[model samples]
Target: MPTSRRYGDACPIARALDVVGERWALLVVRELLLGPLRFADLRRALPGASSNMLTDRLRELETNGVLVRRRPAAPAAATGYELTDTGRRLEPVLDALGAFGSTLPATGAHLSATSVLLYLRGSGRPRAAGTYRLELDDRVFTVRSHDGRVVVVPGEPGTADASLRTDPVTFNALLADPDALPGLVAGGSAAATGAVDRLLAG
Candidate 1:
């Protein structure tokens, strides 16, 4: 953010970008969309982003009111980062971006958990209808798809027809091309059980 202060364009979009246009800024917000995360978890989720860069982004986001430190129930517990109401408003923005990106040719780039989960929300219908829990890296989310619509929320599923475990990168690969699932499973690169086909298929 060496020159992140302002766009000075006065356009609404430019002003909005002025707040979140920095590299990894919107990504930080995306990671917190489902819930909160400690700095370490954020690092794990975004391995490509350097610690110093993330620190700067966090500080800038906080200053701009997009992020806030969570109040721990116990004083000794660690503080985590969660999005403010203004930050949550970016959900549709991210969703629209994901949908738009999907229409383009494959870039073979890595996909973040947030991006992959949003993909499911938009168009990934379950092979069989039911609730399922997804443990992606350091986070857990519940997904349910029916009538060609999918829904995902933070945390474990109360009861599920299936369960899954995998890092987001591998999950992205598996979903992008279902044909690779067998090799991925055999190679121990990805693992999903209990109606595996239902949870990961579109």
Candidate 2:
């Protein structure tokens, strides 16, 4: 950002925007909510972000204490980024933003795996106790729901109690209209149907 760029306002909202209002800044935060992600993983998630732009955003966020950069311990040795306490506090904010955005008409754009993951985390509810394997084309993720909250982990777990396989578009549609789940192509144990039903009822 240019040094001259400024909202020049005293409002808290303006101050917050001053920190994260820049393009791709908040999206970076959104991506890190689930867990630490390597730089390459981040690049894959936000393909529109050029390397320089992404680097600047990460630097700014780190300087602002919204995130931390670290090297994974032993065996891994890869650099990754994760949110700080202040940054994690934005989870609810992003969730609310997502709920509000969903009401808007679709732009007919294709969503990336990371975007879909954010949507699931933003909108998911723990209506059943089990692991749900979500197969989005070739990408897979596991949804573990319990205690009235849902946790989404990357990749399929050893085994899933239920699984939902669909493309991003279909999944987004399902999120908007749970009744439309019948349109989804499903495959799993009968118990999986029950688990998914409970989730959709939300």
Candidate 3:
């Protein structure tokens, strides 16, 4: 449990939560874990969160040394938020939380854009030095590893080795268990217009 500033038994978990346990804080960190994103992008990625609340959370995160805001170099006038090295270490914690969350029954059964981004970050299969474009129905995803960092663009064009096409619910289910893909496709719950099976094989 978290302890007051007064001298008391202060557990590390509690201490850590003190900095990030506030509503929307962790989710904000999750948004930037994969890469830097503009404030507008983060706002779009996290729907339902008010602009004021988001600003508060971002400020708290910065004050706690978990994230940083900076302006992009030449040719770009936009500012973006990025995770600090200390914040990057929280990736494993977030991954474990995701695995655990997958086990619970989904109440809303809706996948937010942030959830999709996190899924892509977590489910991505590391490939050899190469790039591939993924197409799913009308949506396209371009994946590449540049300078040791994975980059995923939602809409881009190129040939692809595999593509998984499914609605958000089916995609979430498949992410929880790759074996569920076939049933989702065969049962008409999902439509795979490309090599979706191969993509989920691993």
Off by over 4 Å in 1: 1-3, 105-109, 124-127
lDDT score for residue 47 of model 3? 70
lDDT of 1 by residue, 1-202 (tens): 4446677898999999999999999999988887888898888778898998999999899989999998789988878999999999988898787778778898746766777887777764445678888888767899887777778888988898877788887887777676777788788877667876766665
Candidate 3 lDDT, tens digit per residue, 1-116?
A: 22213223389888888778877788888877657878887776677678888888888888889999987786667888999998988878888888788689867644644466
Off by over 4 Å in 2: 1-4, 73-77, 124-128, 135-140, 155-159, 164-170, 173-202
Q: What lDDT, from 0 to 1, does candidate 2 have?
A: 0.75
Full-model lDDT for every candidate: 0.82, 0.75, 0.67
Q: Give the TM-score (vs. native) of candidate 3.
A: 0.66
After superposition, candidate 3 runs with Cα above 4 Å error: 1-9, 74-76, 120-131, 134-159, 163-170, 173-194
Using TM-score as the yardstick, the better of models 1 and 2 is 1
Task: Choose the strongest candidate by TM-score.
Answer: 1
Clashes of 2: 0
lDDT of 2 by residue, 125-183 (tens): 54567777877646678887787777787776778776776766667666677776664
* Sliding window of 10 residues with minimal summed lDDT for model 2: 185-194
Clashes of 3: 0
Better candidate by TM-score, 1 or 3: 1
